[model samples]
Target: MNIFLINPPNCGRSIPEERYGITSLKQIFRGEPLALEELAGNLLEHNVRILDLKADPDGLDRELREFPPDVVGITGVTCEANTVLQLAVKVKEACRAIVVIGGIHASNDPGFFNHAAVDYIVVGIGKKAFADLVCALESDTDASALPGVMRTRPGRALERPPLRNTVADLVVEHSPNYELVSRYRSHYILEKLGITMGFVASAFGCPHRCLFCSIQGQTGGGYLTKPIETVVRDIGLLVDIPVIRLVDANTFGDVKRATALGRALFESGLKRQYLADIRSDTVVRHPEMLRQWQEAGLRAVIIGFEEIDDASLLAMNKANKASMNAEAIAILNDLGITIVGDFIISPDYDEDDFDRLGTYLDTRRIDLPMITVMTPLPGTALYLQEHHRIINHNLDYYTLTNAVTTTKLAEERFYSRYAALLANSHQNARL
Candidate 1:
């Protein structure tokens, strides 16, 4: 069977890719469609093609008309819901193909895509389930029985249970078909390093219970990891790319496991730098572990210093103090590793709060300070607690740059202040 997968164009947030830069946000944030790349790897028996709309948005109609695959699969986040649906409609109009949609958006809100063009939905970890679904489609068999899949039929939606295991098992045997996306290699770049990059998932899920986080809800609140050997092998396969970004929710969620992976990479004889996310407490507890990775080409660590106030930290159930964030920043600075600090700007923030945040980042001299307005994303504890307060239900506005709830400051004034902060941070960023 012929298969085609697409990564939809960026929508929702006007936030910059490296929130501290003047470059076009789209250029900085354009990533290779790793989801499509993995799906292509799983469907190795079939002819597969991928089109990342970020790289070429106008090519979709052309591909649908020219290639005319047997199956057209699309994956997107909550913000890309409308865009994916529209793409599905266009694919159905252009070709005699089945449209299957997956990813966090489709999984969380299956009912929203009650369109006739959407033939199927894969809800959870999609590696094996997707391959199985494809085989069933090829054989013209009943697909409702497949795990982690939902089939659309006349006046009915067929459902199945989610897979009990994680995709780490598959990562051991197969890496994303990075070669398929070789044409758009220059588009997938790391802003800090200013070079081409590849994404590798070292682990899955997060064990922490931050109130605003949706990872626990998505992954059944459990953490799973690939073997160190598997991770090293995946990194080696990505040798063509200079930088590798571990797109894990928490690469250091398990300190010991992370340390083992770092040791393996250091000894692997591969000359690739890496970037990953780390919790403040993890850095505080294991600075030396990061030091080892630094020697092994760990360029920077993205830390979510969510808030500056202890009370706010406790409210979010971040399980760490403001002091820990400061300490972690100091440690990374001392280690000579770049730090990408992410902070949430609550909708309730007044002019005073914005000023305070600016002062904090300036005082710390954070390398790249990324800011976002606090959004109550669906499936998160914060969403459940503040569902009634959500004035905007449009997924596009939930990009974290826009306020979906009421704000203390006027919307115009709030955005102006936010824009000012981004410009100021860029000017202050270390050259």
Candidate 2:
């Protein structure tokens, strides 16, 4: 069976443009489609290939004409749902291949892809389900009984167990097929660091219950760490890249496991730099562990100090307080680990709020401050609570940079301040 995986062209708001200056937007962000690589790894026995549309948009038609895949699998996030659907339509029109859509978005809301173009939906952990589907297709057998695989038939929507149930044994033995994306190395970069980068998933899902986050729902409200040996093996596969970005939502969710992985990496004597994310509360509780990691090639950390004030933190159910966030910043600074501090702007933010936030970032000396408008993404508790308030159904604006809810400040004032915040950060970032 010939299977092709595609990372559909991105249509969502660009993270770098919103946080980092637009000058570095294209340079800093464009990551390799690591998810497609993993799915490719699982189907090693088949004629498998991947196409990252961001790297080569025109290549899709060329690949379809020449390779002619029997099955085409596409993945995307909520903000890219429209793009994903359109791409599926294009694939169906161009080739007679079975179209399967799976990713965080599909895992959370599979019903959206129950259109004429999409034949199957692989929810939750898709490696096993996808591989099984390919095998069944090759043998001309029905694959609807497989866990996490949903088949769309006329007048009927086949159901599987809740998305989370399929992830209980998600840690597969196969490493990602990094060789498939080797041609696009230069296209995937961390511009601020000015280096070629590779991605490794050391863990999956976060343990936290932040109301605004959809990750907890994805991981069945628990944490799963890939075995340390497996992570090391995965890193070894990407020997061509100099920097390895741990792409887990929370790399240090389980501090003990994370420390063990760090120690293993340090002992292995790899010279590559590393980056990962963790919670503010974790830093407060495990400052010493972070110190150990700093010596283990840990160059930077992306942390959510979601809100700077106590009331806002409490309202968001962040667990950590404002003082804890400050302490975490102090600890990261003392360790000399570069900090990518993340903050959220509420729709209620006025000029005073923006000024206060700017002052706080300056006082803390954050290496890179990433700010976003608080968005109630679907599958999150916040969405369930505030779905009524979500005036905009356009997923494009739900990118966290755009406000879907009414604002306390006038829309013009809110947007201008947001732009001003970005401009101010670019000036400070140079320092």
Candidate 3:
């Protein structure tokens, strides 16, 4: 089977949906296109080839015209819906290949199957679903029967289970299929950023039930994680890679596992740096774990210090740790791990929040890469709650890099402040 996977164009000046301003910080790193690559690797057992559009979108048309693949896979998030819409048309126009679209955006909303360009939609983790789709295509089976998929028929949409039965093993033993990315490396960010490709996930599912998050609805509202040894092994395998971002919704949710992974990697002499999310309460439970992670060369922690004041924190349901946010930062700083605090700056936050937050970071010298403008995303608790009031229903704008909310604060005021924050940061850092 012949296959192609794409990372659609990211044209926003900010991170998708304006979630956070860390886009300017290369250190925070753009998410690697590992999902499609992993999906590609899984397909390789069947003599299928995967092409990365991220590495080469321009050459894609030429390649598609030449190879005329039996199947093409495109992965995307909310931000890429617009691009995917056009790209899908272009794919079909270029060739008669079957098209499969998968990602968070597609998974949460099964409506993508209705698109004329899509033959099948893989709604869950791409590797397992792609493997099934490839087999179905090879044998000419009814592809809709595959799990986590929904096939478009004459006038009907068939839904399959989109949940990964064993999410922990999705990226196991996977390589980026560099040959594929190389074909399109002209557009690939990894080569330019000097970052080697690696998995960004250690866990899946969100339990917080935040009103604005879509993760739970997409992944089935539970959690999954790999053993610490698996993580250590993965790290050891990527020692030559500059970094391995733990892309878990709760990267360090399992304190013992993360601690063990850190110590094991450090003692293993793997010099590669690591980055991940750290829950405020979780990390505070074991301060020594911070040092353990740092000793393992942890460079940064993308932590949720979301709301500052008591009322706002309570409203945000972010009182998970009460006052532990402050404690977590102090500990991580003492241990020499860069504190890349993640916050949802809202109108509810008064000057005290900024003053205290700024003073805390300054005193600790924590790298506050961004104070994100919180926007409710589909499937997130916020979306489930306030979605009725959302003026914008465009899933494509839900990239977290733009403000898509008609929130407690006026939309214009919220966005303008966010835009000004970006401008001010740009003036200072010019990232």
How many clashing residue pairs appear in each of the predictions shown? 0, 0, 27
Q: Whose lDDT is higher: candidate 1's or candidate 2's?
A: 2
Q: How does residue 63 of candidate 3 score in lDDT?
A: 68
TM-score of 2: 0.94
Model 2 C-alpha RMSD to native? 2.9
Instruction: Report the lDDT tens digits of candidate 1 across residue range 333-402.
Output: 8999988888998989999999999898778868888887788887678989989999889886667777
Candidate 2 clashing pairs, residues 3+ apart or interchain: none
**Which lDDT tens digits does candidate 2 get at residues 1-431?**
88888887757764335644443322224899988888888887899888889888778889888889999999988887888889899999998999999888887767778889999998866777788889999899988887778897636765765344434346368888898988888889877667788999888878778889877644666778888989888888888678889999999988888889889998877777888998888998999889888888888899999898889998998888998888888998888888888899998898899999988876777888888889998777898889999887877556677778888898767777777786777675621
Ranking by lDDT: 2, 1, 3
Q: Give me the candidate number with maximum lDDT.
A: 2
Candidate 2 segments exceeding 4 Å error: 13-28, 153-158, 162-168
Q: lDDT of each structure?
A: 0.81, 0.82, 0.64
Per-model TM-score versus the true fold: 0.93, 0.94, 0.83
Q: What root-mean-square deviation over C-alphas does model 3 reach? A: 4.4
Instruction: Summing lDDT over every window of 10 consecutive residues in candidate 2, give the lowest-scoring window.
Output: 19-28
Error of 3 at 47 (Å): 4.3
- All candidates in order of TM-score, best leading: 2, 1, 3
